[model samples]
Target: MATIAHHPATGAEPAALRLGAGLMALAGVAFIGYAVIFFVRNFTGGFLELGIGPNEVDVGRAQVLAFSPELFRYMSHLHIALSGFIASTGLATAALAWFGVRHGLWWAYVTAIVVPVLALIIALPAHYPYHLATVGHLGLIYVATGIFVAGALVALKPMLQARHT
Candidate 1:
């Protein structure tokens, strides 16, 4: 028989942490939704075309298309793999935020913010000068990243206080 350790309700967490956790959860669901859209839409047209209008092409899109068939195929695979990674990371961040909201765990606060920022960072190299073009201005990637960071900042106080205790 296994016993589950219960953590008493830590009382109402600071509003900031609650807000952060809520944002984290929102970001996670958004990521998962983005992944579904990405998979359904199928970014078979190379990287820059990802999350952007299919007819919208720019210099970067042209360059990516100039690659050899094998290279282009490889890049497409990379894009798909990245999508999966982002979805998984978002899900993990959201789940952890719940714990952070309840207990103010330092790691949860950090991860909630870091994961989305990391996703943005990951896009930097791959998307390059066309980062914004690759993923639309209103895309979930941009929106969720902002939300996660904002939420983390909002909750920073409690997280910091918890660290010293």
Candidate 2:
């Protein structure tokens, strides 16, 4: 495995870099935790999101259970798949942030940013058209994204400086 190397100009990593990477990692962990919730809800029938209840979700668990077993199974499958993807993304982001960005690797920084941003870009728009963009469904993600952005911004100066020197 590749190891993090300190920049020649900078003998030790800067505090800013560490803080930024830590924030990014925290965001990544949040994603993982959310994924876990999604996964557990699949089995436990806690289909309600944070601020959303069965009524707001447009379909109650009881209704789905009564209407079609197939539909319920399909929904469960979707939840499993979504959870897997989210967890994987979180794992990647955390690894990159803690291992690469913490070490001041520019490529790692870029990739860490790209991975989650790409996911949000692909996933977020669909929510709006369906009016599913409510805070209950997306608030946690928004907070995580904010932390990721803050981390990126915080590390930017130091990363650039390390690169130039």
Candidate 3:
């Protein structure tokens, strides 16, 4: 006869961990969706959410075209690259949450928290100084950040407990 031993710490996942992972996953999806929007907007010109309409976009495009076609092309490349990076980060975050954080891995929890924080730290300040941080322009990111923060908080205790055990 074979004997099986079960440890409490290795039991079924806690509800808190599940909820936190779900929230983080939701935020990751939001980030991916935003990236898609950004990629489309690169071609469409102007952000409708920011109240920059077609006419404004057209005027801006013409000005940029007149200033330098190469510069305009470079800007397009930058937008596309930024969109790709955002989507990749989102995917990575979601994967970590689902596969790592949900399983109560401290490293996963730390990574899930760090990725977006680094991105925001690098990207957000430019928006504020440029006066581009309008509610319409940044509201979604704000909401997603809030959800991510909530998830990190919710999962923190469980992760700590798991680490000690």
Pick by lDDT: which candidate is best?
2
Candidate 3 Cα misplacement greater than 4 A, ranges: 1-11, 47-59
Positional deviation of 89 in candidate 2, in angstroms?
0.5
Instruction: List, residue by residue over 1-165, the lDDT tens digit for candidate 2.
Output: 333346578776788889999999999999999899888877875754445575457776678878998998888788889999999999999999998898888889999999999999999998887677888789999999999999999888788876666
**Prediction RMSDs, each to the true structure:** 5.9, 3.3, 5.0
Reference-based TM-score, model 1: 0.67
Model 1 agreement with the true structure over 1-165: per-residue lDDT tens digits: 211122358556667667877877777878877776665444543344344654455444346567566766676676677669868977888888776643577666666667767776766566556544444634567787787667677666666666665
Worst 10 residues of 2 by lDDT: 1-10
Q: Provide the TM-score for each candidate, comma-separated.
A: 0.67, 0.89, 0.83
Report lDDT per candidate.
Answer: 0.65, 0.85, 0.78
Candidate 1 root-mean-square deviation in Å: 5.9
Predicted model with the maximum TM-score: 2
Select the stronger candidate by lDDT from 1 and 3.
Answer: 3
Candidate 3 whole-model C-alpha lDDT, 0 to 1: 0.78
